[model samples]
Target: MAGEELKPSTVISLADAMQAYSAGRYAEAEDIGCRIAAVHPNDPAVWNLLGVVARMTGRQPEAVACYRRGIAVAPDYAALWSNLGNALKDLKRCEAAIVCHRRALELEPDVATSLHNLGVALTAAGRDGEALHAYDAALAIEPANENVIWDRALSRLRLGDYAGGWQDYEARFGRDELPKRDLPGMRWNGGPYAGKTLLVAAEQGLGDGIWVARYLKRVKALGGEMIVECREPSRALLASMGVADRIILQGEPLPAVDFHIPQCSLPGVFTPDEAAIPTEPYITADPQERARLAPIIAAAAGERLKVGIVWGGSGTYASRADRDAKLAYFLAHFNIPGVQLFSLQKGPQEEELKALPAAPVVHLTPHTADMFETAAAVAELDLVIMTDTSVAHLAGALGKPVWVLLCRVPHWMWQYGRSDCAWYPSMRLFRQRTWGDWTGAFDEAAAALQMLVLQRSGKLLTV
Candidate 1:
């Protein structure tokens, strides 16, 4: 041996712990770490490693405890503080988590990762401006930090800083962590469409397609030949944006063009600000589609005023996908007397509607041919109420009379702490004050519908 020394038993155990952790043997890692911790109670590294293992294994409380123990042992480890903050955030202790992140940033400023985490915690706490600053701080150190830039853009959007937000919103494409687009066999760079035609395809969820399809009009305004390739659910709606030169299902073939842009890239290309929101509902039911569905809607809508309702969206979230509002959940608590209800809901929820008391209501969801058909049906309605679904986006995009019911932690488009959606001038938001409790939202919706009903009858009720 170059240097004669006794190998520390605790250090050996720690090395074993690291190996186990790296091998994905979480239980083995936990045991090895605990053994070292028992022998070297003063070693903060052991505790920190244990915390990481705990966090990895979904024992968030244990992770928090381990982090705290590490911090107590060595209060100066900025990384330990940051890890603790992340654990607290997983526990929904956002305020405490931000404090820990801030402390870590203070002790070692300009750390990009911690700064990004700090922005996330701030945004979760509904502190948008501070979150924006945190993200900006991270960007100041690493300008192309994609996630930080994305967060900053969202924060800008929520604060109604339209120009800056849309300008930055373009950063989402081709980034790591974003879903890979299933190229419908062709792609383009969005070059001038003067003599060339490009097929703009949609790569994300239907809501995204709906929101960004507003840019298709800009493309049309640019005097280019363009066709919108969208999710099957969005064909009609995209067609109605008054811009797409053609509308087809995702992956459908189209006339060649100079370049192509994803539907969601419209904001990036058009630089949409509040002034450029394309607020008017340009998509609607064509005369034939409306006429075809008139009998069905009329029969279902009957003497009572019709309210097309959807309380959930297609699953686009990773965590808590199960929290989607089931129509039965809301209907169980609802007893709207004069408001004849129709379920404009699509996908899996349509199957469940067969079990509800819908004799007074109608379900034309399955019959809808496209977004245009849906919009036509929606246009026939006195109002549309829905969960954070593409239906909401369509109604909102169309500037139809829409009432959106959102989960407490809704999609970013609703913006932070918002009761109104600027994207759709006629849309109103009713958010869950607490997660999974639609009672409050339903109560508000019921009241609003009552007011709407009263208004229809020439009675003005003050809110």
Candidate 2:
């Protein structure tokens, strides 16, 4: 009923454009699609083809405009509505995206793809309960849809359903995003390897490596020579744990181990629920590194409450910006009288400090050569405050007093409707109430820091 208005000639041209898009020739597809759109401005297929090409080429705004134009002409077309919803979600316009997706579902109620898109939009809006229902409805229609299952896993995990979530999370290995590991040994089945060596292969972000490092001690207790393979940046930090019989940097020669388990999968093996999560301080700062940095920190901080800060995480994830807080935002709000801010940020983002006019925070990247050095610097601080990042995991692992600034819908591990972190007893979570709003979380952290300073000063005076 929606696309039947297209002429036979227009349909043939649309097919050619779709074939080009399928073959990954987006430019060719876009050229053909644009030509059709110019000639047949009223045809929904032409606009849909143009929108798909625009989205595939990473021009999400153009895709939204194309979809809007198509919807104006053919409002009954469910595909255009669904495409618009997806583009809006990519732009972080969750509420509008949800409405667009629901409208598409109203037009094509049985379409699993529309339901899946709606679920994703709902999740972004932090309405994960409703998101789960949408995902379930999609799964009921297309029982083996990996896209639907994967998103449902995230929703379940965010809602603190670790058991069901982890079970479904195994679907990630089947998906392309996480990348499958092709190691030498047999995949360890989470059982004891009494006489054999167990290799813990690290995967994903540096924060994930640090978060899963806690499971190494548990693996060692299962009675085997524990070998951990980690990225170069995390090598020193994992080595300091002392749980692994050997720490191997990633891309090095594979050691002869009887069994191998992905570092992340270790959680699924051991942790059944939130209460089963291992407590923090499993990771320790190199004692020598700490001793070397402590005097330097004392010299700079003096009597001030030494506060370390990390404003951004790794720039890999598309959704990372949601979790990032601007350095200026922190400096503006955290103008407490007794606190001295220290930058623990690395990577290209550290350049943001130089661009700023009068940055009060002391830059500590020069002192931090690796995770060991970073951990030591963090240990010297009275408290660590940061957006959700690897440094937050580092500080949390070391059992330091760390406050984490969270997006409205943060990572599954942060959970929903909670201020305390189960994995890190010393870590406190400050979450945004509204989507894409960091000011609320930052303001709360500033207020909390003021109280912490007063508490510490009162304790010092008593002594």
Candidate 3:
């Protein structure tokens, strides 16, 4: 009813634009939407479509402008308000987005999208309990909403309800964002695959692959041959650690297997209880690789205590920006008298090292290309100080002493409020006392690092 009374040419153009957007031709849709907006400046529908296309194309600011323009034209449009809220949420304006979502809900009380958006905003604002209630209300309206179900899973897990959490987490497989694998076998249902091959396909990030590989040994002991499918970067390291009987890269042609399971689902099958989590390091560096890199690292260290530092994770990660610590923070805080810091950071964030603040921390990331090399380099280090990144998982997997700086509400794997990680014996968690407050975490880490440095230098006896 919104754009129905327009001219015939305008109607056809609007239809074309909507079809293009629905078909995933965002660029074409954006061009058409802009043309329509220019010709019919009063049409809120055209502006709304432009906003959607802009948001889909990673133009959040443009999307916000378009949504604002649409709101100006049709101030009472509930859909426009909800859409604007989503864009604002993406821009990390959680409180403002929440306000928009609430206004949308006031206009259209039964709108599931508004409810779901409200849930997401609340979750980002660290109100997970209220977020769950919002999600529940949305689910009541639309029971099979995958997005709401997946988000609800995260909220449940954050609250430390593993039993309730894992069940809902299964909804992630159906979410469109995650790449789905279509293997030619039955899904593993926590049963023994005696004398058969079980393909453990990789899902999610490289760190998740390494984290879940711990359960592969258990899968092996179940009287079955296990084939672990992982990313190319992880294959060598995981193979070296003997995570499975056979290791294969993700894009390789699948070998015949009786059943298959995603790596992330391992926790649901094996260790559902938090207390029963395996603490021993299941991944180890190759002996030859470790031997080869040990001298190179020692020479770089000279006479000081070697500490590997990773200030950032992959930028593609959803929470990378949130998890990242300022390189300057580490440079200023980690200046222990007898300690020599080495950067284990890689990717685009590596460029930040050029601005190192008078601290002579060596950058070892160039020497470590893949996880195998990272594990080898980590093995040679005295300690690792890192944010919530793959390097932390790698250091922990190698049984190296790692101090992991966590966000106030860290990933579900870290669990609720414990300083020591149950999965990695050598890893210590430094959590933020307040949300988005890395300073407090850094202060605690600095004190612990000072004690460690003193112990290393024989100035203190206890660690």
lDDT for model 2, on a 0 to 1 scale? 0.88
Choose the strongest candidate by TM-score: 2
Better model by lDDT, 2 or 3?
Answer: 2
lDDT of 1: 0.75
| Residue range with the least summed lDDT across 10 consecutive positions in model 1 | 1-10
Q: What is the TM-score of candidate 2?
A: 0.94
Model 3: per-residue Cα lDDT over 237-258, one tens digit each: 8878655888888888999889
The 10-residue segment with the lowest total lDDT in model 2: 1-10
**Candidate 2: residue 37 Cα off by (Å):** 1.1
What does candidate 1's lDDT look like per residue over 1-463, in tens digits? 1112223676776788889899999998887777677667788998899999999988999999999998998998898899999998777688999999989988898899999999888876677888888888889999987777887888887777877887677677657756555444345544455766676776777778877776666676555677778777666556555677777786656545556667776765655456656677656667887888878888866777878877556655553352367777556533376677887877676767776554444777877866778877887777787777777877776677888777665666687566777678888888777645678887888777777677776786565
Task: Kindly report the root-mean-square deviation of model 3 from the true structure over all alpha carbons.
Answer: 3.8
TM-score of each: 0.82, 0.94, 0.86
Q: Is candidate 1 or candidate 3 better by TM-score?
A: 3
Between candidates 1 and 2, the TM-score winner: 2
Better of 2 and 3 by TM-score: 2
lDDT of candidate model 3 versus the reference: 0.85
